[model samples]
Target: MLSYAGIQNPYALGKYSVEKNAKVMQRYRFIHESLLRIAAGHLPAREDWDIKVALGKHLYEDAEAADRLRARITELRTSSAVLNQEPDAALSLLMDELIHARNDLELMVGIYGVIKPALLDAYRSHTATTQQIVDQPTIRMLRSMILDLEDQLSWGEQMIVSLQQSGIYGDNGDQFKAGIASLLAAAGGIDGQQPKTAVLPHRIRSHEPYRIPLKSVRDPRKMGPVTWARTSVLNPPEDPVQRSLLAKMRVRQEEMTAAELIAAVLFSQKNMPWEFYRDLARHLWDEVRHALFGQAALESEGIDWMSRPQYTSDYDVNAPKIPGAQYAWLAIGIEEGAMKRPGKAGEFEFCRDEAKHPLMTQFQDYDWADEVVHANLGRKWSPDLIGEDISFVREIAKNELDHFWTEVRRAQAQWNEGAS
Candidate 1:
């Protein structure tokens, strides 16, 4: 078992007072909520593959850390509910502004550069001030979470550098940095502000849900329908050109769905357990990686994936505003369908042997593995949201897919009519 030396008597000398423990837990809760909000808000605005994957990973880690903090509070013989105590008015205002960032650059600079650094400083200060032996559990949790925060800090800095090099900020790069600094200062600088008793309105609401604005989505044809018929395990394609086309389509579908999944989970964060959101975020990131693999395979064959038309609308755009469970069930069904007989594995084999495409086969192999994991994740979490009834889940999934295809077909007809 793991051990911490020089900690024989936990509460013997320099024991942490109840008030101090309460304060620390309260601050942790504030940071926890802030991280979730940041993750949710930034996700939809960002379309770059690398940045999307990073944000998903960061959100998962932050959510897990928040849970650990809650657990620590419970260990101190205090109710975890107390951690939801009112946040500082200034900090709350700062978070509100951060969430409303106009673009990815602003969101990245505000959250990673400003808010995250302040949270990191707070964690460090807590670790330093609290008696290590008496508060060893909290200390250990803070230390583990600190590593993730540091990684985020490094990534955020690199992102800023990349933005500067790209000249996207024009001659205003320094101006943006200064603006972020000012915002940080307003929220009481890197150490964080003292908590105020004034409660803010509920930020994560089901009614006023956060949806990805259709206009903000990168592809102009994201809502456009596929012209080709849907491929199935029972009726596989034979022609090499058709197979390549199918592979490219699969990549595009995964990319679009992954983006939708990221937004859906963020919107549904309040309705589900933190652990559920955490797991789903990791799955979302994996789907992103799968999309990247698909893109790479197409690029290897000298195919411009972007030039191709997308076949489906985002799930978030079509699904009802309430109960994110609908999206989850829909995703599970889609993943299961992909992994059925003559599915991704069969596709991989065909690419390798018949199509004689080595790189395509490699991409399919990994994509197959990722899909299996995703299906298992769906199996694990779907029951929690809907129930143990597998048939019900499958039914929901099938209906959603059908509706999606219908919408796609309609959109495609309109596009064709417009072209003619």
Candidate 2:
């Protein structure tokens, strides 16, 4: 529903608050969109090596952008200068924020300067003058970086301005001086060493005191995975065809797993959004490892299994997220291509798999986890970016559904021919 935005952080799957979640989502939107753009022009019409190279380079740039973001994450994570008034706490938190900000500013400038020289070399190294850079690789790279900066404005400058207007700062000196002191002593001394379990630093002045429990501990859905495990056992595929199709998928899993890490390294360094690529690599590893387990289960049935396309590519990791944005949930993957896909929501009725394996179930799981944050991203930042209307989010979901069903039917056709 409209409230699904709060589900953005599957890691914190149970946590919810319209305001806080929206802010987190705002950051995600900028990062996610920038990644998608890198692959827009590069994805070729055919599944060939050239296309793969283009995808890989696109992904590499996206990863570089994430690295750029990581350089600044420490700025947010470091101690807050005004930890709601802990005595001389003002002295450290106040001082730290400015110090951290300055360091970040320097880092930003350094990155820009290094990239700027690279851009210049490209222009000098090229065949045409500056006017003809429309197709130049260097220009495209610079454009990606510039767009990244533009997107950052959603929270970059605006957040700082909002902070200034809040009057946490004092006209004469740090307003938090006393509160900072008591808070620090309450937490521990400046040394970060405290006696046994005495109370140390946990208060900040606010309109209300709130208590919240960690949801991951409370939510059963947060468990390692329910569907695949349950489906394999409880709902075995009824027909030989269906069972055989799934068995093939099990074999493919091994192929995917075998190359997952190497694919990740190739994709990240050359093509993916490097920061996001790391996650893709790990997910690939998980899928690969999971495949072996699935194979073990199949071996029990005396099935000699061999599946999956033995191939490698350099493509953007987050590229899957884009399709999932339009079709199903953004799982780490979409198993079928457009023509090779499965069922529809309305026309198609469910068929028992005996052992359940919906065409793109991993993607479905991904959507369930990712779409929540994506929904939240729209509500959280659309007001600031597009102002008040969330029509775009609807369009996005519609597209994802369209793609999803297309693949499912392809899968179902495979099922129909194969399933008894």
Candidate 3:
């Protein structure tokens, strides 16, 4: 018989029958959903680079965890559909409160300090209570998650400590502490109680109206307002004779980053499948990395990225309102346009042969690969949201791109006139 030293004769059989395992898996599924909701709600609303990247990383990890939990349920021969259902009412409320936190500090404290600790405790108890031999797979999964969560907790505590040292919260630390305490109490004093079934609202309420200002961009230092210019993905350089390949690459990456970031924020605001947000968040983070690649390249060339005059056109500015499937299609179109004939492949080839810069070649190669994946993602998700008419979607994407360039030219003229 499967046994452990501490497991008594009565409990040696393990706490999980098939039904019990399903129930536990269901609870874990709810927890994963809650984490995803929190990540999606907070990430787009944040402006600070540190917070944004950290939250983005956290979101990606949570998404992976959620995916794993669903797979585990299926492995146990249980219906993974329970994952699509509403989470415990109290857990949902806790997530809502965290999402609605007035500021980043409050959010960090509530999630890392209170919610995470409670979750860690519950997972520990579950692992301990579970039969080590019979439930080895589940135990192994929870243990792996525990390691990640511990790292997350450490990072969170450091963030809170840093905030305290910076005097950002001043005397309000006690207030924040009390707020966390209250949430923990409501969540059944850290160990977590069985969540009651409560009716879910028709619409999820947001703490603030989501808006992406036309001129907003995240940078490390304060710089003067830069005029936005639209550039072509097909032809990055209007005059290859004047501009270096590295320069063109940098600009292209920055512009793409801007678009990706904006799309991520807009998509997060909409009520979509959790999987959609998860995939989008991962893509958003990759775009950030791409932008950094450009930033690094420029700095290596003794160029101050912040001082460069950048221009964005009306299409890039107002693309957020295009709505639902169209928004996704815009991204798909861009990626497809870049990856196909006369596309980014040309740029990669040029960088590899003429530029002779290994790093630039490497970046472009990976970028090309990523866009292919994104195009496929767009193909997979966008059609269901709109319909299966692939040609119609492509046409809409083409028209939007044309409109975008037209706005860019007009905006350029207006900017030049104002400057002169």
Candidate 4:
């Protein structure tokens, strides 16, 4: 049977011209940039653990969305110059206020309550109005983004409710969101298609631009300055097999120290290609996942993971001492070692073959896969940030890692002596 061409369909293309579609994407791209920046900038200072993880994931998700839009926009036009420019100043102002969120409460309300929901709406509107057949590629890209945005919105909404129950999100939540709404109103909404209001709200962040904090803060549960790997004093397991399992889990949970450093690098390093930020965002999120694996493993054994000492020292040493570009190269260098024989691969084998532990095996399997990707990303992009000499980058990275572990050993020694 022959399928009828355009059965029960209107012959007319939908509303947008190529130029108009590109403009809409530009607006979305800028908003995604704002989302990425806010998530990365506030990560170091955001104290809530769950929220911190959400930010790690969201930053990467936002970067992916923006990168997709950038790709689509390039297809729509000749020069990629338009992707680099801000689509609207009022829009930029709105973003500035959003990122300047004074506390976690304000951050949640601004991003979840106001901006992201608006962004979701704008995306839905564009998808609905654009010519479906002519702009099929864009429509496909946006469909995927919309699914992610919806999931993110649901997560954010639940987080807001949790905050409200804890009494952190109060009446001021409405007020803060209103301020953001007014800024968006002045900017003519996320798509820049609405009527622009000339008068703008008094800028809350007028005092100074938001500065990315050099250090990340954690909840009260985080006890640190003690290195996890070198000493078994804090997380001592009696049985040999159990001790080995817990030891590896500790490594995974402490992966956050690495994630925190990556977040700092993303925020501090500027003017790199968009690909750098995008790749680092994924790297940061992967480290967070590794940390969660460790957390979960410990908890499964009826252990209080957070109650034990966390390793805050890795981030402490490198974040202050090194430039972001150098820090990035250092991370890539570490991952290269991690992918080798005695690292992730060996860990996976221990879990699967020797330990006879299915869950830890699963964890190690994915952990190995993630590091492979991270190592590949490092090899591809590290040279661009540092120099083309791979061996030199590796040497510098090794020395830095060695120095960081040396300082960690010294701290552990003093701690052990004090305890004794």
Candidate 5:
């Protein structure tokens, strides 16, 4: 078999399985509204023992047919929530949760994967029967997804040609991939997730992309040229306290950036962890400017600065430890988490000219595309990256995910808690 860097190359099967897992995973999510509504209608508090015993037999029956109905769930509509079988209020919250899940029930059950068909088919069928699926916004979502995936696939296919030219696939692309299948199987040997015809993600586990939580998200602030410029300046200070505050801000930025760089080193590897390289490069760039931005913001303050944005503390357990982690936590889990939470994009000031916030777009982009990559890495290569006996690595990654998110929220609070 032709090898990229030499002896027994792997990752090809990981890539292939990752792609297929992604499509299956996405199909589960696309149809969630229908499921939420159905669950809400059948048993508003299905997790409650009283409700479970008395009314939620459907969840069990539904679980049995996970494979058959999941595809349909990906295409459920709002109207599906209002079906004859459902109560209106429960249905609303179902849409609300589909729109938002602050509770962990959804994450725990891994409902996004196998049982998706039950929800989507129910909603879609309701749409046709009840005439409630005509929202223009929903239609736009459907159309845009179709277009976006087509574009991604086009680019993915083109890149394969470049990959072929890179001296690795010396004309035996198929055979090369076949050999790597063994590597993937070896990797999979350590992977606890079994690729049953249906899919599921590790619930409550940090960095497991499918592990959805019902956490509320923070929105990114809009930075216009004037605002950006104003924040970047540090006016000369008169008092000793003001001068001291200036110094502290500089030190904080350095600390955060240094911590992030150290964590980046933890992910360093060549050839195999391709995305890790991109993450490392992006983080270094963010760190380079982190202190500069803080300095500029600090200097403008006429009064003594209270505190600098911290990147680590018991509080920042979920705060992003690195730039790539920051982007992933914010862009994937939180932003997408908002799609199912209260005040969503708007709550976070995810606005544009009141309409075109880049952060929101980035959130959507990461949620729909990169999340699949994140999850697949866990599912396909858990052994190789962390090792067969190393459950410790998985534990550590989740701890980091928790810290990374916590850090961002603290940063927001620090910024908001400023001058009256």
Candidate 6:
């Protein structure tokens, strides 16, 4: 036989059959969905600002991985209809335990220390066994997923360490993680191919169903009133220099509400297209990044943002309402309004010209750019999700915004009266 350039041996083929590969892909899909669920579920409940931000970013990555896995799975023997089907009952139960983990430390130990590393191993095993030339597409997909998973695991490890150092981990934290690991072992590990040596562990989900938070949680050390941005003492300083400082502080602290609202929508809405979730997840992460930008800006000025109030009203009011209404209000009204004059661009120019702060100018510059994308994201997804014309959604969102500001004003008045 003539030699082929790509083959080690002309007669040899890869180890896994088509059916086997598809099953592996299904397992990957399930892991990714669980990742999405874990991150979205915790975004509102997790109090640490950095942890919340990290969850926002991870959820977006989870959504992306899930989307890609679906495409690859569809190309296999299975139909698209089976894409959402549960791969294994035990695996499903395992996820329930992770989602219902007692606290942030336990959740960290389960997800990062156990599930994620196992997932990475499964991906590596598949790639190593599969034929590279014949299964190039799957190989490529797994490669991308591996990169993202590695990055997430890196951060997850550091975060776990930070949690441990802070003395937050309960004495039972390791035992809790071990119980979860034993459950995974009973479930046949991440790939569902390992021996079921251990029996199912006790489940937190059994005691109580996991409820997504109705409002965003803030760290007690950093907690503040929802009126922080509205109060002149905290924001909108008369001095230009202080104005820029406060603006960054406002963004760093206040955008948590945006993240909380977006996560609420992702968790609550089930009927929207997968693309809607992906885009909105990205939108959620962008808001978190913007908040981080504000954090960085404040750090540059030796200001402790935790010393100031982080606003919660934006999440508090909308979270309990219909998610559709919240989405419409934010995407259509506030974000679109931000695209106009004296909004993001105006803020940028103020930092550049009046404040003459180079760091603030750069921060606002990107802030303006991000808002432009968010405005378009609102236009693209909000109308379809809300089942209304864009104009009508805009009008409705405007009314909602008006009502919100009215409440803000009323609260401000009460604060003033109390002081007098």
- Per-model TM against the reference: 0.73, 0.25, 0.77, 0.91, 0.22, 0.90
Model 1, span 178-255: residue lDDT tens:
565555565455444443333443432223434445422443332233333322112236875666656554554446
- Per-candidate Cα RMSD to the true structure, in Å, reads 6.1, 23.9, 5.5, 2.8, 22.4, 3.2
Question: Judged by TM-score, which candidate is best?
Answer: 4
Every candidate's lDDT: 0.62, 0.32, 0.61, 0.78, 0.32, 0.79
Q: Which 10-residue span in candidate 6 carries the lowest summed lDDT? A: 226-235
Off by over 4 Å in 3: 1-21, 164-177, 189-227, 230-249, 252-278, 299-322, 412-420
Model 4 lDDT at residue 169: 51
As a TM-score, model 6 comes out at 0.90
Residue 72 error, candidate 2, Å: 17
> Of 1 and 4, which scores higher on lDDT?
4
Report the alpha-carbon TM-score of model 4 versus the true structure.
0.91
Model 1 scores a C-alpha lDDT of 0.62
At residue 28, candidate 1 shows an lDDT of 65
The per-residue C-alpha lDDT of model 5 at residue 344 equals: 37
The residue-by-residue lDDT of candidate 6 on 1-420, one tens digit each, is 245645434344787777878887788788777778778878888877778888888888888898998898888877987776889878888888788776778878888899999989988877777876678788788888899989999999998898888885656379878878888898898877887755555665646767887767788755554452343234455876777557655565478788888888887777777788888888999888877877777777776667555677677777767877888878878899988898888889888987788987887898789889889988897788778988988988998899778776777678778666
Report the lDDT tens digits of candidate 3 across residue range 184-282: 465454334545233433223355543433343443243324455533132234656325675655564454334444344434455666677667656
User: Which tens-of-lDDT digit does each residue in 1-420 have in candidate 2?
Assistant: 245443222233223233322223223323333333323221221122222232333334444544443443223342322111223332233222211211222212212222223223332332232222222332343455555444443333443343345454333122343343343344333222334244333434322321111110111222122111112222447887566545444533333322222232222233323333444433333443444444554555555433212221112122243222312222211321111224121101222234354533443343234333433433443233322244654455446546655654565465456434
Single out the weakest 10-residue window by summed lDDT for candidate 3. Answer: 196-205
3 versus 5: better lDDT goes to: 3
Mind giving the per-residue lDDT tens digits that candidate 5 earns over 111-172? 32212323343334322332122222232333343443344334434444444454543442
Candidate 6 or 1, higher lDDT: 6
C-alpha lDDT (0 to 100) for residue 392 of candidate 6: 86
